[model samples]
Target: MIEYDSYGRMKYDPQLHFNQGKTWVDEDIDYLIHWLEIIGYEEMSLALGRTEATVRDKVFKLRKKGLMKEGDKSKRHRKLLGRCKDEQAVNY
Candidate 1:
């Protein structure tokens, strides 16, 4: 259940929070992955009102910690795409 403003916008409903002074929660990671699958990472970042890198980092960290099973290929693909864009940008 997501909270929505009167204008049909999602409100600032944070599923993730710092516990005992700044710690990542598994549930939060799971939630993010779930949404990422549905909306993609960029839109998930927008919906979370966070930067794209932040969201990507969270996924990466979780994968490193074994808190996530997916995203390995996605991460690789993103990096490859980034490199391609950078090369293209330089040539242009």
Candidate 2:
């Protein structure tokens, strides 16, 4: 069964998220970059079977490493495009 926190947010479940806490594979990172450009973290999380937080963290690390640009359109305008509203709310 699914579980939620007191705040009504779904808790992380290893059974549901097989990659949770595991090392990311190269292909996974490639797919992340590809999809991240076309979609928001929320959709990318669902597609990658990862938590949204995990996806966001990965993006941050990528940016810090110079793997992703700070000026990337996805990062600059995802909220303006009406994508990832949930993520935007969390950031605020």
What is candidate 2's local distance difference test score? 0.65
| Candidate 2: tens digits of C-alpha lDDT, residues 1-92 | 44444443335766556677879888989998767867776557656777767887898999899887663553532322132434422221
Can you give the TM-score per candidate against the true fold? Answer: 0.46, 0.62
Best TM-score among the predictions, by candidate number: 2
Error of 1 at 39 (Å): 1.2
Candidate 2, residue 81: the lDDT equals 19
lDDT of each: 0.50, 0.65
Q: Provide the lowest-lDDT 10-residue window in model 2.
A: 76-85
* Tens-place lDDT digits, model 1, residues 1-92: 33333433333334421121245456656678676766666456555555455676788877788866674344421321122322322111
Candidate 2: list runs displaced more than 4 Å.
1-10, 71-92
